[model samples]
Target: MDITLKSTLPGHQNPVFCVEKGYYADTFFTAGNDKGVVEWDIEHNAFKRILCAVSSSVYALRLIIGTPILAIALREGKLLFVDVEEQKLIASLQLGIKAIFALAHMSWKNELLAVGEAGTLHVIDLSTYQSIYEKRISTTTIRAIAIDEGLGRIALGDKDGQVYLLDSTDFHVITDLKLHNMPTTSLAFIHNKLLSGGRDAQLVISNPNQLHDNFSFVPHLFTVYGIYPHPEAPIFATVSRDKSLKFWSSDDFALLKNISREKMQDGHHLSVNAGAWSQNGQYFFSVSDDKLVKIWEIKKIDKLVANS
Candidate 1:
């Protein structure tokens, strides 16, 4: 695949914490230590507008699929539901989480899972948009959550460097492993494997139920903040505090593209906190502590057939 910097967008006054593909086709959203969720148009390389404003720093954002509501996770332990179609705040849910770091929608189960600071996990029934269960699974902050509905597993990573695979139905720990010496900062399930990254600058690929089937490597110089897989391709991207975004092959887990800050003129100079691929897989968006949102244009390589 061939990737290049398409544009650099600057607007956020503070470090950008998270980025997520919006409910729409060509749109995406980003937030951080910012006051509002800013929406951007990927097709025209422009800012759409602030979808809504909140009272605290935004740590995470996710879309409630099949609807106009966007879930905004705030720093003060509150979840805000915003109606993007009307550009208004719909409702709020406070679970006493202290802060929220990640959110995942189990659309198949009609549930939403939110895990965050103080090791709190909140399960909300989308049917009612209310808390179904709230529990503290760890003594420290839980930084990552990945739900595999097909496999019936929920992968949780914590600041204590522990990784747990839980039963998606009951949220019970199925497998437990210490994968990092420092905090496990990110986690994602890709192609039947759980890909985890951490503050120890390491990346690990392992099976959810079989703990012996796994391998680890140091892929960054600092914290690996986010792992984002392409919407359709067998490839994924990991961003880090080292100020670079790395593309890896899911087929062999090989490093394919490294967008390093030192070489790319538009690359992030500070910690690249998070990234998300466009819904159509034509472009990629990354945000950083440098307070810039960068759009990267991607092109899949095509091989011509050999003439007989």
Candidate 2:
């Protein structure tokens, strides 16, 4: 299937680092190396405002569920909370001396986890905005993080191609597995399994508890930049440096369709740096180094059967 470019919203002075959907409105937030977070209104197809600014490049951003607050991570190891509706700075915290790479929020417990370039995890309580627990994993840089509310687990992937599972409540290390030879770039939980992508040009699926076993890798044409699961379907999308978005069936890891920027004729001309699936899962958005954003609608599939 071909991807149609809906529109292009260009305002960032540098490459975008992350894009997140707003919890309470029809808006989306994007953070980039320009040290600012821009709020884009999807319904209007344009940017509404530059929500906030930081001292250094914003490397990570996460929207807390059921709140108007946003967690912004800076390259200088500072995390700030911005109230989106009122456009005010709610709070701010510093993570000592290490640069933060990823951020995740636990909706159930209202806790925020920040991972640093040194593979240190800091768990912060939203109510008091205090650090409850912290752990360091040797000498690896944490690249990605995912929270599993169902199993009370937090997954952390590092630059050395290792994934570590820890108890979300106590921050105890549960298990550690070396999953790839290259840095793990992204992680997503789908269908009772964990999906991971990395610079090794491989996508892997495995059980979160038993990461050392029951693992499978599928080779890709280019470095896998991001992997996101559909909200309500049995499929997910993978973005690569080759400028192609491929949809895969989660059950069997089969490629269902490929969407390339060239096919859309939208002048999409950069390696995909980041991509995200909407909350409703009906549409997906991707941002590239070429300074363009493209949204694609997912097509439903019908089963075909024949009498044997």
Candidate 3:
């Protein structure tokens, strides 16, 4: 990948598990073992402020676009809705499960879907901020979720190493694929294709239309905790417990760059828990067990060519 470490934002008191887009294009949010979700200004790599404080660790965060509301999933299965603009906890709901692992916002359906240790998916009606539906999709935990709006499909990966494609609106299972030998820890929709990462340290990218026909490779030495696809670039990144962040070609899933502890003196020493690209794809952010968020500035291809 034609990228380099731009700067590191340090303030999270504990391991940061998730990073997400902020209200603006130049801003973003991150949370994890820490007690509050944090907002950062990317322009100066500055920590803006704590968006909201929580009682337990945060596992995932999603900002409802065009609104000040921030959705937080906690380790204890409590989901909090906070209005960042007003800076107050507006609503809190318990999904009645433990360790809510992921949350997918369906803008088209105006719902929030959360999955966790219970293997039951909780559907929250964003309009009411209440649980409207719940269903157990696996005997094991559903650790990852990715909604492909263009395809009208939602991809879910479970602790059983199985990835299921579901009808986004009706929540009916369309197809299931066994992509890993261990728990499928992360999932992403790179355009129309589905990419998955696993505890087996494997990365599999496949055409969702024909799930069985796929490409697989071992991308890390430990569990792949995150898979972040660029909103506009032809590349994606995966962070791992192996304490490394890697960039891959979206076209062929080729290893483009491997930023590891062995190669970079400034890389995360602990497991890189999660990563996200900015809404404009100008920068990439990664959070880790080391209690830090590192930002990578992307240099444009045209700029690189001119410099070359």
The local distance difference test score of model 2 is: 0.77
TM-score of each: 0.95, 0.91, 0.94
Clashing pairs in 3: none
Q: Over 4 Å off in model 3, which ranges?
A: 301-308
* Clash count per candidate: 0, 0, 0
Please report how far candidate 2 places residue 203 from its true position, in Å. 0.8
Which residue pairs overlap in candidate 2's backbone?
none
Every model: Cα RMSD to truth? 2.7, 3.4, 2.4
Flag regions of model 1 displaced more than 4 Å.
301-308
| Descending-lDDT candidate ranking | 3, 1, 2
The TM-score ranking, best first, is: 1, 3, 2
TM-score of 2: 0.91
Write model 1 residue lDDT over 1-308, tens digit each, in one string.
58989889988999999998888888999999988999998878899999988889999999888998899999999998898999988789987849998999988888889998879779998877899897778899999998877898898999989998888888887778898899999999898888899999989989877545889988888999998877677788899999999888878888988898576666788999999887777788999999999999886522201110
TM-score, cand. 3:
0.94
| Alpha-carbon deviation at 48 in model 2, angstroms | 1.1
Clash pairs for candidate 1: none
**Which stretch of 10 consecutive residues in model 1 shows the poorest summed lDDT?**
299-308
